[model samples]
Target chain A: MQPNGQLSRFGAMKVALHRLAFVVLVAAAFGLMLLGKADTVLVTRLSHAVTDALAPVLEVMSKPAASVGAVMNNIRELAAIREENARLREENQRLLRWQTLARQLQVENQRLRDLANLVPDPRPRSITGRVVADTGGVFARSLLVTVGARDGARKGQVVVAAEGLVGRLTEVGARSSRVLLLTDINSKIPVVMEESRARAILVGDNSNRPELAFLKAKAGVSPGDRIVTSGVTGAFPPGLPVGVVASVDEGHIRVELFIEEGRLELVRILDYGPDGIIADPGPGAAARAGTD
Target chain B: MRPTLWQTLDQTARRLIPFGLSLLLLLLAIVPMTTPGFLRAGPMITLLCVYYWAVHRPDMMGYLGGFSLGLLEDILMNTPLGVSSLILMLTQMVVLTQYRFFVGRPFLITWWALALVALGAILLKALAIALLSGYVVAPGPLIASYVLTLLLYPILAWVFARTQILLTKEP
Candidate 1:
């Protein structure tokens, strides 16, 4: 073969190889997505590993953002203080009345339980974690909390804030945990209306308000109705306040979450039971040893 | 002959600038913006950087770099692995192929091309996510993201251009 022909052939080969590399890279990405869906454990572990390594750096980066947020919030609050004050005053009066009634009912219930000789269920323990990073994107809604597996955070644990239910711990790492917000498209919660006791599923669409689905026909759910976790599936504890029904028009009910995403700085992670409950490792080991 | 210490350091710094900037953009993407609508309409800065570097320094940025960056985004944002990777790699490949066309074009032409690429990238992301999750991922957020990404392209490109100038300066 001629030298120029050899060179041209080599160039063609290089072009083919380049195209092949591009195809291979795309195929590899597609394969990863499919693999992640098929085998969630591998994805979970990988997610945890990556988050754990980057948690410190994310935490540092988030501090400046948090400060900026605080300043903005303060400015907004100051502007709205007058109207907010009046609204809070009215709310405070209404809540005071409810508090009195609730205290009386609680006392009567305890007395009734005592008379019946019933054993009370154990109260769940909770750990507070600071928000270190938030991946608020068009595709997903998740936040990384400073606490993790080492801090007693575990998958399926309930993460809440002062306002209401925030989300669940989806991936817990050694030093960080990812909170899958209730607003994530993939998040679905079994909830019930406080007033009507009608059960439904809260489905997130990456919006501030999630929609209610699987509601019984003519369940009589209406706007302003309170929603709480049903706890029927055991994924979350019962009676955790989730949100209030914002609108119920044409069979579509939107829930206005009590917790705002911007205000999510600190959250509480609740440990309910022995199934992956985050207890001190020492005590947990001792308990297992005792059982054995 | 082996590279001297100064030469090795110079090479390392050159590689780190673009790679490090890519990562910094990722962190910026997730940074908690308190302003309403900011969170929902967060710009795809990493995507922008990927496109820019792929155009400017195709030799340094490739499939592996794009894939790794995308994987980082997926893990950070909790999306299915490879969702961002697939889109990012394709974006890099497309830009690299059209490098000559973009190289000498007016800023407006490059920006226009970037807008189209951004649209495709976002659509690809939404489609991949919907297929993987088996849910009809809404197109609203994706469109918002696309527009925001395109709008921010000029500012980001200016910054990137300055960085390029600094990087190319002789010691």
Candidate 2:
């Protein structure tokens, strides 16, 4: 690859040096990959540090696209307003009926709780954060939200969309945090089929539909069954709305997450301070959560 | 004759423009388009930038700069830390080695070269991520991004071509 006969020894030496630099850089990159695997702590800190340092700049840079997206969404919403209003009106009527029944059941449930002397579920506080960046790639599905450790967000806190549980915080920074979306391969959420009570792990395979694995054989799970966090592991709160079973393939149970691909502009990160639903997050997430 | 200090500074800044533009593209890639189903359809602007400059101005776009930008993308996108670094540097290496052939070629030929290089790049990235994570990644979404990258080369190439002409013009 010497230049077409304008090739001097000096030019040859420069190309050699350039290739050498590339080789050295590629080696260094592979070395960093090794370091990332062997020392997740260092890698995690580096991710947090860089993301935290650049959060404001990232926020500002993302605004133009955000505005454009907002405009597009506004137009679409405007177009659908008539149908949406009618649907909401019908939904309001149905909800009004449920409201009276819910009030009656509330009294009965409270009376039963008093009779049994049961401890009540503590209400966890929540903090709202804007979706600053969708950090997903071909391999990992993730997001960077504006809320972070400064805002009481932590490693194990859960993120909920308007529809359902979307993801969990895997890394918390000073002004931003990374949400490992339920579709990421590294994510293994302990969820259960709400109707059948069958326990399984919702496994992300880098696909739109995260599949359910480890379901008990012959478990009566079919399409339309609801899936929720099982509370089997305390990493996530139990009973957070997750998604519905989209299909039940041979062994794969594909779930359609409520947080659609493009509409996650804002998310809610529940505070997992003392007396939160995460009673014991085992040795992994809780310890990291406590440290930061 | 030797250039004056201001002229030297202006020339230096011009040399940095390609890298600056490439960085801007990388920053914008992580921002969502906000329309559903359009996220995966966005092209790899960084890859195209690297290829465009490597073909036209290899001296300006160095391996170290490309590697740094790749690392930045990894941090911003929350991918495995070094994966993008490897993919981008390797892609630049391909263009650097073969850019002479691509220069002054038909637009179709240049686009064809980008198509081949982009294909190799995505497959390499997918393979690396699969090996690292031990999960079988679906190829559909990855290929979708690649197709968009293919579709983008012509439009972005015209912009880069204009910038190159500007660089060569008299001040």
Candidate 3:
């Protein structure tokens, strides 16, 4: 009789535990629902930590698949190599003519540079890294690159591709870093209209075409106008190519980004820190020492 | 005299089988979560898992387990909170209620029932997302995803039943 009573008690305890777990799970779901849009610093750190832990496992799994994809791509490329060669030959001739023009422009640029003393001789070091992982999920517009703080990657450093600007490194781990893409909803870049010199906010809407919000009506912006960084925020350098104005619909403007977000292969993380350029020290060595 | 080793094995399997099945379903959820183009308007793998387990082993894969899987998917896929959880809980409840009909059905009939369940789950998910975001949800992707899921269900059901049989040794 005592053993039967004990068995029933144990069963009751087990049922209670199961009910407790259920309550916890439901509470977690409701908690996540309530905490929407509150970007706390702790959450950012947690996201980076989770990405850092998962990136290596993902990288290992993706390599074999990528190798198979590469082999398939090579086979396809071989089949089209003859036609591609003919196209490249014609493109090479056109490029040679452009190269001669580029040489003449370089000579004229040198002359202009000597006259204006405008060359600042930028820091000539950069770490090249491959884009190993894409943005983690549907809503996140960030990427995890292979380079991290161990590879001289620091937070707030601008990351760019061969085409144009990519984004800035927001969080850095020892082995991997998170880059907030320019097309993320939270990203807001101050940009200047290349043609009109008017300033506007390049706002990302988590879509392919980010909108240009907060542009003045008299800014005189039009479609096909070029957009470049205004460097007002100081995170990005001045005069970096951003995108082109694709459409202007009433008050909302959309830009066709220069660097394709989906097809990013390799990127160069600039060593240019936020304080890359200091104000002129006014010709005094002691003043420069204090600023440094 | 001591109980036979076969009896011990049976007892162990009876007690631990549900945990193993739930873990397998959780691992399956990771595949769809990681694959791109699948995250937004792709076949719902977790829903399939919930339906399969809810029908076959409701005692092991309960309402709470389904809800947790949905929550985990929501976090991993970055969907709006409670979206997947709500869908999964409803899917599990529906499957549980209708499980008696599926107990002795042939494999083809089981596949058809799963297709109906998947279609209902996808429609619910699309409708919820559309209402929440206030964007016109495209029905084309939803229908395509549902069809793909339905086509894949037969193969998965076969594998699931084979595993269950092998593990339980009840054939």
Candidate 4:
């Protein structure tokens, strides 16, 4: 629409402006990174505000994803129904038998507790929340739940699915919270071998299976050993089922967590009370909660 | 020098299309898909949008739009604030600088260029994340994401092209 010479001049100006914009943007981003590093509270507040604003929209967007997941699950479930039915029938019979024994043990346990006058720990309370977003990718593992500080969700609370420990509540927003899954590289939980009572740390490495670390020398942990929360760290209550040791190689002991992070829909956040190991997080604790 | 109301509204709508599309991409990236392997390392859908808009409508989606979208992603994904912002801003710069070569290329050529750009951008993102987190991120999943993003680009590009047509054809 213009003369060639004029068009070329206009093109040069546009390109120059774009280059200048690029430089300004890069510099601004660099400055933000430095700001993020120097002031975690500011970064956390910024993240929280942004996440809070987007939570409702993200929740709406995730509905189709959840339905697709449900449909896929139904298809998979349909494939082996006959064999699964038989297996479940047999397992139900076995569970019925164990139910009788468990009742007897409960009666005896109550009597022993009465005799010993042991002050029972308060039963942990829980609040349920829906998964609104999944931030996991190749590098980090985390999910944003629909519950937040207004719902009494706090940092360091244990998040669980029906199967077992999902992770811990790391960041609590005004209307949303971030759950750091146990498979995240930053996740570390204290666990004990159910059979052997040997203590170790469950460390995530951004894989489906987390590894057992800092096991005592000659602790005799083997594949298939059931692991549970030791309650020693006070972060998690004792006896919560964690996972089974999947393998015991020369140096690595991997655990397949009972929770399937992919199928997570509703998660329960457990409040272990004042005496619980996770200290009551104060104002600045939000920024420091993920550090350790 | 003031424009009529309809012209102003038309210009506003045109300007918003790229930003709105890119924001939609950012939202899509975080959608919780339970499908194994797909959601774990889902294609970088937002990155594809940045490249598409940079190629087709650089006037509308500038470095600021790229930075804002990238920052939104970083906040949503809970990564260091500027990691994605920096990568996306640079992606815009790269695509715009090479715009002349790509302007009239065949589809395959553009596709290949996009794949290469995506690969480099994702690799740069990985390096930045590792450096920021002070941990060596495993490259296995990153490579998987890169490949998946490359494979899905054509489909996404087609979608973006349709949206562009819609934007340009609006009265």
Query: Which prediction has the highest DockQ against the true structure?
Result: 4
lDDT by residue (A227-261, candidate 4, tens digit) is: 99887767887788999999988888999889877
Off by over 4 Å in 4: A1-13, A274-292, B1-3, B34-36
> Considering TM-score, where higher is better, how would the candidates rank from best to worst?
4, 2, 1, 3
lDDT of 2 by residue, A47-96 (tens): 88888887776688767778887788799999999999999999999999
TM-score against native, each model: 0.87, 0.89, 0.70, 0.90
Model 2 residue pairs with clashes = none
* DockQ, structure candidate 3: 0.21
- List the DockQ of the predictions in order: 0.61, 0.61, 0.21, 0.62
Least accurate 10 contiguous residues by lDDT in model 3 chain A? A283-292
| lDDT, model 3, position B74 | 54
- Candidate 2, residue A174: the lDDT equals 88
lDDT of 3 by residue, B1-171 (tens): 697999888766664555455444443333212344443334566677677666775665676767766765554444555667878877776775676887867767867888787878877776765555544344565576688677666656676667667666652
Model 3 C-alpha lDDT per residue in residues A1-292, reported as the tens digit of each score: 9999999999999878866765666566555555533556654555556556755765665565456656776999999999999999999999999999999999998998677555443463578876655542233466667787889888888888888888888778777786788877667888888777788888875566788987786347778899988776656667789999998776778999898665565688988644453434445435434422
lDDT of 3 at A58: 52
Give the residue spans of candidate 1 off by over 4 A: A1-24, A40-42, A80-97, A116-119, A217-219, A275-292, B1-3, B33-36
| Candidate 3 segments exceeding 4 Å error | A1-17, A32-45, A119-125, A136-138, A193-198, A215-226, A244-253, A274-292, B1-51, B58-171
Ranking by lDDT: 4, 1, 2, 3
Candidate 4 lDDT over residue span B15-35, tens digit each: 888889879877876777644
Each candidate's interface RMSD: 1.9, 2.1, 5.2, 1.7
